[model samples]
Target: MNPVATWRRLLAELLGTALLVTAVVGSGIMAATLSPDDVGLQLLQNSIATAFALGALILTFGPVSGAHFNPVVSAADWFLGRRTGTGLSLRDLAGYTVAQTIGAIAGSVLANLMFDLAAVDISAKTRTGTHLWLGEVVATTGLLLLIFALARSGRAAVAPAAVGAYIGAAYWFTSSTSFANPAVSIGRAFTDTFAGISPGSLPGFIAAQLIGLALGVGLLLALYPDVAAAAEKVVIPAERAARRQRAASRR
Candidate 1:
């Protein structure tokens, strides 16, 4: 594996999370500040925009970094035996979590600055509850199903589109605006601005998403038992072929 590339991938995650959070919170604030009349419409447009950007980013950088924009996705991939380098180091998880959270908070702050809304809490406008919980299940399940289809078909090439479309559609169809990510959920909680989950809403929302992720992985695996075979081999071996050859000659 390219060690340099690995670091680059991690940095990409950092940058990607920043960009995602910025766009998401920015759109929400714009809706509140500008199109308050049709907040729903604005949110829909925002969701589409975010989904497209995320999809394109994943397509562009997936080969280099696996395009794991969400911590949950990274964790899921590791759980399913995709990312195998020491398998989720505590230090890296902490670093990634901090990066995602910071990026999220910075985005909200920037949105606040741009909207000039007198430090209003952004979470007030968010949707959550048992309804939101069910939405999480629906949205995340759709994501996992789409991903499972792509992987099992040996269509890793189409993963980014599959994932993006799933999220985009889930946003509307599920009645919850489809977060489907734990890091993003926590980040959004810091604000009471547009698209911010009410501070009171964050914990249950996070729990729902985590549960959805677990169930999604489980369901996808159950449905596609052979999905792992289609996965690209990135395993590191103990011996180099040249070393094996020299040993055979010595023997």
Candidate 2:
């Protein structure tokens, strides 16, 4: 791949992630402030904002960088493509992860600044225990399953809406409110707000998410054995359509 293309992809990942975290943290802050007396209302408002923001962001960036604002998604793509050498390169994986992590943190800081808070503050919310871990596992597993299955079924075009809808629903169903993405989890830890998770709880959440990633991969392989076809479907629908048109014109 061209170095220029690689850099452009990395920048897209970074900006997408930053905007995503900003939506999460900023909305959480607003929700908490506006509905200080009603926790349920606060959660509802935050979840709705997050869902809409995520769908918009993915639609905006998927063509450029797969819109994998989550590290687990990126890692899964790399692993599934390893044998065929058609997915992200190891260098791309590393760069994406680093860019996402940095973007997440920066997003938290930006949200805080926008709300007239400190740039960075440790969260006090402690989310732990077996049930929460189980929630994390279920959330992350379901997320990966949804993404890969869509790719395998050649429905990547619907990913933005499907993913966002799933996440919004998971927020109500999952005990942990679906902190399924490791990068987002880390970013939330920087805010001492309604959406923030304590730094001490970060390791456990990440571990559960990783376990979920493994399970999701196993399910993907078992259900979609044609890895090559699945990989090809990862491209956005517009690009795929254009390529088909070009091929037909050539013939």
Count of backbone clashes, every candidate in sequence? 8, 0
Native-to-model Cα distance after best TM-score fit, residue 140 in candidate 1, in Å = 1.6
**Candidate 2 residue-pair clash tally:** 0
Off by over 4 Å in 2: 1-4, 235-238, 241-251
Strongest candidate by TM-score: 2
Evaluate all candidate structures by whole-model CA lDDT and list the values in order.
0.65, 0.86
Best by lDDT: 2
Q: Over the stretch 67-167, how does candidate 1's per-residue lDDT look in tens digits?
A: 55666665655566554443334455555566666666666666667777544465675465798898887777677667656655645556667777777
Cα shift from native, residue 161, model 2 (Å): 0.6
- Which window of ten consecutive residues has the lowest lDDT sum in model 1? 232-241
The C-alpha local distance difference test score for the whole of candidate 2 amounts to 0.86
TM-score per model over all chains: 0.78, 0.93
